[model samples]
Target: MAVQDRGERSRRSILEAAASVFDERGYDAASTTEILARSGLTRGALYHHFPSKEAIAAALVAAQSEALMVPEHPVRLQAMVDLTLEYARRLRSDPVLRASVRLTVEQSSFNRPGMTPYRQSADAILGLLREAERQGEMLPGVDLEELTQFIVGAFTGVQLMSQVYCGRQDLMARVSTMWRLLLPSIATPGVLMRLRTTPPPSVAGAEGDGVREGDAETDGTARPPVTPRAPWG
Candidate 1:
């Protein structure tokens, strides 16, 4: 029992330590030796939990991406932009995510494993958009997949821009700009209220992306209960 408890503590220590170092130095500059010294773990132990630095990096990305899927809050956004904005906020706040962002921006290759964290994230956003369409929370005239990618990809672009320049604390204004530009077309006023009122809480951040990825893979067979929608889309 003691051994297992110690193992868990060591694992968590490494996770936190890595987050701190990566947060401070960014990913490419972070080294296993530095993470080991910070976490108070031996190299053997660190290697046991995460086989490679890239794997550790993937774990970090997974941690933040997972946060976006927490159960809907009362004041959360019901429209597509609102949903994506919540995710962008989480990415901004999370450490592993910042590293991933840094890596994606700095690195030039799609062949790298580092790309996987966000690889499926875009798909998840599109999945939710499709579900919104099915629930009648979206207009009837749009092409479902195209619109989903368009809306989601647009937010991704906005978030990347904000992250590259403004940092998370000031991101809301830019995300709000994206929201305003977007809302006029697809989101009804009622839908916008849900978004404006229900920004995702920090507590619910980083909880359920894997379940959602699975849900999306099954063609949303396990779609979450729809957030309340406006009377018109």
Candidate 2:
């Protein structure tokens, strides 16, 4: 038990140190030696947990999805919206997620392994949209795959703009705006009315406002659920 716990701690230390470097320097400029130096671990220790710098980058990329996992909301579309808001909120503080995002954009600089982060994000949103469709929340005949890809692409553009404009300090607001413009076209009218386009205080400014993410409410006034309208001929 002691041996396993120590190994886990060491692994975590290496990942955290690597994340900080990657977030700051992008994948091409970050080095294993610097990661090891920041981790305060021997070369052998880092190599034991991660054989190469690419391996470490891959691990961080794979973990980004975990950080965005929101609790299942009663309204599935709301859950989808919350996932993006949570990601925007996390970008302010989560080194791993930031590093992963950096690596994703710099994919041309280095060989990124396994599934791309964009695909993973699309898959997650597609799952939520599928659930929302089952619950009659989406407009009929909308292409789930195409909509998922567009949502992921739109978010990528928004976050990049936010980062350039204000270092992602206003990313939550930007994401909320994205949903506001998107939901009307994709969601049932009643579902759109029930959804919140504003990021709750927690996602907008949890640290500054002293509100917890859990305290954010998902519910609005109940309205009769409306069936989706068929596509126009």
Candidate 3:
């Protein structure tokens, strides 16, 4: 058990270090030696976990899927908004996530394969939108799949622009603007009023809230139930 635990720790160290290097220097420019130095792990240990630099990059790309903590809300649309807002907050603080975003965006330039992270994110959003539609939270005639694609694309652009312009310091604000613009078109008026573009004060302070990867539940805060109002006469 000790040996296995040590191995796991070693692997994580390598990945974190590699992520930092990749975050600072693009994939093509980041060197294994720099990762080794950052991790303080021997060449043999790194090779034991990741055989090549591309493998490290692939692992980082895959890690992006775990970055968002999607809480369950009675209203699927509210949950979607929470997911985006929380993700934007995280983008400002999580190094691994930032690196994952960078690698995913630059994958074509780096000649790496597998966009599983992007597909997984799209599928998750699509599922939420589909549920929102079923519950009549979405606008009539809304295309769930197309809306999913649009949200994902818009988020990617927003985060990238935030990173480029303000070093992501204003990501949460930018995300709020995005949600304000998108909700009117995607959600029913009642749902739109109930959804919050900004994170609640508690949630904002808990930006560093340490939820484990793959955990679907929120950190015990009660979310408001979705209440759809009657359309205006």
TM-score per prediction, in order, is 0.68, 0.83, 0.86
| Predicted candidate 3 versus true structure: per-residue lDDT over 1-233, tens digit per residue | 99999999999999989989999998988999999999999999999999999899888877777866667789898888888877876676678888888887875446664566668888888888888889999889888888888899999999999888978777766777788777888788867877776665466445354742322233223555323232341
Q: RMSD for all candidates, in order, please.
A: 9.0, 5.5, 5.1
Comparing candidate 1 with candidate 2, which one achieves the higher lDDT? Answer: 2
Show where candidate 2 strays beyond 4 Å.
200-233
Question: Which 10 consecutive residues of model 2 have the lowest summed lDDT?
Answer: 214-223
* TM-score winner between candidates 1 and 3: 3
lDDT of 2 by residue, 20-66 (tens): 99988888888888998999999999989988888898888888878
The per-residue C-alpha lDDT of model 3 at residue 56 equals 90
**Clash pairs for candidate 1:** 67-206, 67-207, 75-197, 75-198, 76-198, 77-195
Q: What lDDT would candidate 1 get against the real structure?
A: 0.59
Q: Stretches of candidate 3 above 4 Å error?
A: 107-109, 207-233
Report the lDDT tens digits of candidate 1 across residue range 136-165: 566557675666566656666777777668
- Cα deviation of 27 in candidate 2 (Å)? 1.3
In candidate 3, the residue pairs with backbone N, CA or C atoms under 3 Å apart (3 or more residues apart, or in different chains) clash, namely: none
The deviation in Å at residue 81 for candidate 3 is 0.9
Q: What is the C-alpha RMSD, rounded to one decimal, of candidate 3? A: 5.1
